[model samples]
Target chain A: MSESDIAAAFEDGPAFVPYLTAGDPTFESSIEYVEALERGGADVIELGLPFSEPIAEGPTIQQAIVRSLADGMTPVRFFEFVETLAVDVPLVCMTYYNLIYQYGEEEGPRPFVERAAAAGVDGLIVPDLPVEEAQPLRTACDALGVDLIFIVAPTTTDDRLDPLLEHSSGYVYVQARLGVTGARSDVSDHTSHSLDRLKGYDLPAAVGFGISTGEQAGEIVAGGADGIIVGSALVDIVADGYENDLSVEETADRLEAKANELTTGITEQGQPRSERL
Target chain B: MSETFGRYGGQYVPEALMPALEELTDAYQRYVLNNEDGFMDEFRQRLETFGGRPTPLQRAEQLSERYGTEVYLKREDLVHGGAHKLNNALGQVLLAKYMGKERIIAETGAGQHGTATAMAAAHLDMPCEIYMGRTDTNRQRPNVFRMRLNNAEVTPVDIGRGTLKEAISEALRDWAHTVETTHYVIGSVVGPHPFPQLVDAFQAVISAEIRDQLRERTGALPDSVVACAGGGSNAMGTFHHFVDEEPVDLYAIEAGGSSLEVDQARGVAPNSASLTTGTEGVLHGARTRVLQDGHGQIMESHSVSAGLDYAGVGPELAHLVETGRVTPDSVGDDTALAGFHRLSQTEGIIPALETSHAIGWLEEATPEQLGERVVLTVSGRGDKDLETVLEETAERDIPAAPQMNVFSNPTTGGDGNE
Candidate 1:
């Protein structure tokens, strides 16, 4: 599908993106959680691939990776889980470049992307891959009709931003701060400034990191973001409720409630059709 | 012991290193059972002629009288190059030669292990490289200079907290890339499999010597053995040989940092005392008990002793504690400093701050509890720690004390002066 087609899916309302670590708590929960995220209002779901040393995560997401690894999670297992889940949401496997470099050759990203597309995934977001290094995967993703989303941090210079915007498809991920992803009491003022600069570009822009509550979702949408990405906070909720005997239904319901809270506020306060046109 | 003692020690490492760890484990197991080829004899010959072994066991008579219990010091300080670290470094280097590797690499914090590795590599006439944290290089300039003097290249690691942990990561990354010609000689018993076991075996010579020496002197085994645990090679080595022997109390003391309560709450919060606070987790490709949160992030641990500052302990030590083979304890930085001063003032022996953990435990052993005898592993000499001692003493405003004139008054043979 083209960018316009994906944009059309969100024309009726503001898009919701839910982020969760793959194989978190357990692989089964991650699969069910994605479906639950979609059902509750997520137009796209960012599935995080856990890494042993994540240089870019705060304590909360780092803890999620640990919990996932402790439960026997690996990159291979994560891809296999994605293949089996068969969910309908646009599954974007989000990860650092190290995981891909470590395991992508043996289990090629093309095959993984094809299987994910067959299993209902639509894109991928590799945070650390710069435009120079993204060509090979971008070609593979283009061949497979899978979107390759790139991140633009608040620190990205104008020279870097233009090329990133030119190469990016699906939606641009706007990091809220210079630091790693985690819950923070306040978002950076630079995020709003970056969003304003990104408005000139004709791609959908979503704001992520440090956005947890409903009020923050409304604020980001009002500030001109096409969508809002909620990650560490929602993952923290699921992780906090994780138990040895947690059923799939209970986990789904819990995640759905979180998704509803984030999406409802964005939809209610987002730009109306008249204002955008 | 729960297959890994609650996720603390296991094979959570890269696939490339697995064969090496397996080979090491097999070699160690065989060496322990039957030294049919006189491995220990050759090892001892090297120790005496080069590395130095059978370092004197001196009775701390003054401290013994003052504390009302007999205290014997196993002077690892007397070893060549002034610390017990060489015992393991020499052994591991020899193993590397046996394995037919041409180059050696290692990581060091406070530069002790780097210096030791450089010494071993120099003796073996092998190429050596040591990765050290930039922060540690600045603080431990003397040892850093010592490493360079021994002709080892020192790569300063500047990433991720800039400590021993980060140095280990950089070294591992290097080892992964250059696995064919390089042997990564781990400094302590904290890395992936076969390391904890191998280092423990080499250092176990300390306890084995203590066992024989105590038998000859006391005509019976002492009630307990104590040593400091930094990655716990010395403590585990000393404790492991006696694990099967009943009635011998083995204790490993960890740096408690500021306080026990604060350290426990920090839990790998970048302070030492891995056994007391670290949970089952993986780091540096080894499944071991680590001070980490629910998510696999490494925690910050605190310690006054630079040598003891780490986020994890040895897997074997964790296993020993889990199986009730030994007891682990913590002593704060202040108590360790006090122990250092007490040993100096009472016995004229300046102990390493890392070894002061063992010295501090002496306070817990009452005269009745210690019974007639006790032996402690004085893991390293205090030469490298002179600046640290002076700095700490100055900060604490300790009274100016007179230096004992042992060399001038030769009649007393430097005995019972304190």
Candidate 2:
């Protein structure tokens, strides 16, 4: 489908997306886990390409990447693992710029974008690549019909938002706070303020980071977010499941149950809140 | 000697860096066994020319007189980088060059070791990279600029809490990925394997010099030798040579931050004490005694001195404490700052904030208990701490209550409340 079609789906209701690192613990487990997330409630599945240094992540996601790397996960192998999954949900490849710069070379993200899209990846999240330097990847992704999602932090100013909104296709990623991703005890007031400020933009603004519980997910949707990205908390749930000595299938089942419970509760609660006078 | 204090000093690094640590251990062992011709000559040549060794030993006369004891200071501050850290950096950089390593990578807190490593690497014409926390880089801009001036690439780690711990984590990750030609020159007597041992050996010159100097001046070793324990490198270095000597009493002073009461109340006490309160645990890939929680999660430590602000102590020090070879003591920030001021006033020498903990303990010791002579390791110079000292002094003008005299409070019924 086209970028406009994907953006139009969010107008109906808030999108429920799930993210999992490729090859966490083991490669096959990650594939199974992603498919499980899709089966559970995920609208768009984000598959993180683990790198040695993940500057944008908090401890939970960092630990996942570390475990995946320890299990001999690499970029080439991660892409190959994605290829074998035969995932039904629209897959978005989330990775840092360093891994792409090192592995992509002069031909840049074109080859990777083409290969990834062919393997069923619908979009991408390159957190470190600012809008100015994103033109090369944007052109390549546009040619391949792949949506390149852009992120804006709470600290991101108004002047920076206009330029970013121009190139943004699928949906604008609005970080919940100024800090890195984690399960914060308190929701950021700035998240709603930032979303309201970005309302004039053309794209759907999905709020992420620190959105853990069903209550929080429902609140974001109530506050006018098009989608809520629950990353670290879900990764923490998967990590906790692994610690229980659960088999890959058992771990996937437990994580999917958690995602389903959280998303279903959010949607149910969200409907009543929005229907109220 | 088995080259291990316990299970603590064995090689526990990634398989890639095992050979280098082993090679360093082997070369150092061989060098120690045979004082071959030109061994000391080459070492001294490098020391005089590169490291600027044989750092002077000063006597803190006025501070000693105030406490009614004789105190002599081993001046590690006189080295090239204004800190004792250069002693290990110079040795490691040379060894890396000797082993045909093309690049040097190190981690730093407060930027002392980073600047020192950058200096050594620059002098040797080897490419160097130092990882420092973004918070530290902002706090220690002078040292960060100094490292950059020396042509070392400074990578600010903005991850985790963005402190020394995070910097070390980043350095370790970088080293693991580029282990082929990069040498991770660890800053302290921490990490796995020969690092703690190797760094101690290089820094052992501190005590070896103290032994010779004491014998020449007094014709005998002092009753007790004291030094501060950060990673326990300087303390271990000064104490290792005298461990077997029955007459010498060894002491490793730890940073108590504000007070033991404050730390204990806040549930942050253990992290403050590197040797005294730390327990057996693992951190930064090393099995050692660390100030951690029940689940082995490293706790936060607070100290006026950034250098001593770590949760873990060196493994060798742990073994030493276990064997009763050394006694551990904790000194509060007030006493340490007083010690810093006293040393500056009396000896015309400045001590690192880490070393002031040792000096603070000395200030509190009884004259008779201190005996005629006491030698303490003045681990690093206080130039880098000028800003910190001035800032702290401005914040608190009152002199610290006498540590010993506070115990004689009449209202508390001699229960030590001041």
Candidate 3:
């Protein structure tokens, strides 16, 4: 899909991408969560491939990962679930490099990129695979017609930006904050500056890393971001409501309600959503 | 900066961290490597005034008698903080200060590195946080208290068997969010490019002094130089200098927890012997010998010494071992403890459990293998290990595991020396 296609998916505003951790609580719940996200008007679904060591995530997502792994989530198991669930939206596989490397079985007969592409994965984002060492995985991803997206942080230098943008596809992940991915009270102050710097690049951009509320989403869209990535806040809702002993349908209802609030906030023009909330 | 170790190191990190890593690499190059504007003087002065440089190479008369050779102990344990960990810690803290960073973060396994880092941060008046595996925090209690006393926040990580790798992941996560203000003081010669090389240069002081001290004692280099390898920092420090000297046999003793050999019948994971029997894989940013399952999932390593329990060996050690520059050896739990007791009884020196691996190897080495005048590095003191050693010795039955037949194996010792 082209950048314009992604832009078109988010009619009237920036794309609202909801990231769901696969196999949270149970494998079935993960599918249900994604379904609810789609109903709440998610333009793109970023499926988190839970890793044993997720160094790029904060406590909220880390706990989700721990829960996912406890449910016996492995690389092969993740692909099997993706194949079975078969979500209709643009599905992106997000995880650390080790999982892809392990699942790829570098020495084994088959690489994971092949298996993921065959299983209907649309894009790939290994947070730990730098542009310097992405050729092998990129080669395999290219052959399988899978888009390999790259992330550019606020701390990224001017010289390094071009290489990352050149290699990225299916919209680039522009980190608004300097830290790991988690919901913050407000978006980073440097978000506007980063977006302005990235404006020159032809690629469609989305802002992530600590983007919490609908107001924050609206601000990012106003700042020229093509999409808004929401992860921890949505994941945290499921985690917080988990102890209340909700059924699968009830869980999806609660999650969809929260997703709708975020979706509405992104489409509306105003200050960061936290202040409005 | 490229992440590779003579075909073993490469930067396999995320693009999000590329700018930070490159900036760090450039800072390291400008300040430490290039010694831009006399930066080395400040680093060296700190090592001298704060770290107590030129640690003694004490002659072990009783140990020499027992081993039937002249044995000299490179006393890194005598350095401030009671371990060689401070050498690397002090240098990194200096670099962080040079970078104008106010907050410092690090990951520790045995808490020695954490205490050393905390001490450096304290001296420099920087706020410090250390990520430690809960298991290690519980095992090495005194060091935990020491880090706290120095005002460093000691967070006990409770994930994935609660070990070093888990602590590292936590530190890495913390670093990702606060890349500009925070500096990570990685404790070993592992990880991405410049880190492995940077850490080794800081640690190479162990060998630099040994070269001078050994010549002063024996008028020539010893027949062999020995040190224990965990992430292989101290061993890398001790072995790196001797690699070019063909006749000086470089030996690295890794922890062999229950046994080095894998029990196919019993279906047990082999002890923490990475070079002995491990495949080449990427772990903790460096492509090195790692104890991984067939599918490349990192295996949990077992050792009596928590300091030597890592599944991955240092990349330089991996390359050196591959190129026949360093001979890899193993010392199991029971024997390492036995070596600990013997050192205390005979030499009046209570060696750290990690350091005892080298002492244990000496106990079994024939006169033919370990020639006259051997230098052993006591990487750290044993005060921190007394509780675990006493408890383990009290609770366990002593059934001695058979040592591997290393003498017959040409590949066991580096082929170039033997």
For model 3 the TM-score comes to 0.91
lDDT of 1 by residue, B93-120 (tens): 8777766788999999867888989999
Per-residue CA lDDT of model 3 for B1-418, tens digit only, reads: 4467676877766566677778779888899889987788888888888999989999999988878889999999998999999999998998988888879999999898999999999999999999999999988899999999999999999877888878988888888777778889999888877788889989998998999988886789989899999898999998778888899998999888897766533323457888887778777666788876644556777898988888888888899999988989888888898888778777888889999889889988878768998999999999999877765664444333122224454332232223
Task: List the lowest-lDDT window of 10 residues for candidate 3 chain B.
Answer: B409-418
**What are the per-model DockQ values?**
0.03, 0.02, 0.52
Clashes of 3: 15
Candidates 1 and 2 compared by DockQ, better number = 1
Q: For residues A1-277, could you state the per-residue lDDT of candidate 2 as single tens digits?
A: 4444456546556777778888887887888888888777877777898754454566788889878866877667877888888666677889865355435444355867877777777888976565755787899888988888888765565666778788778888887765566787778897889888987776777888888777888888788777778788878867987788788888888778878866785576454312321
Best by lDDT: 3
DockQ of 1: 0.03
iRMSD, all candidates: 13.0, 16.3, 1.9
Ranking by DockQ: 3, 1, 2
Alpha-carbon lDDT of model 1 = 0.73
The C-alpha stretches of model 1 lying farther than 4 A from their native spots are A1-277, B1-8, B26-40, B261-270, B397-418
Error of 3 at B119 (Å): 1.5
The candidate with the higher TM-score, 2 or 3, is 3
**Looking at candidate 1, what is the lDDT of residue A179?**
55
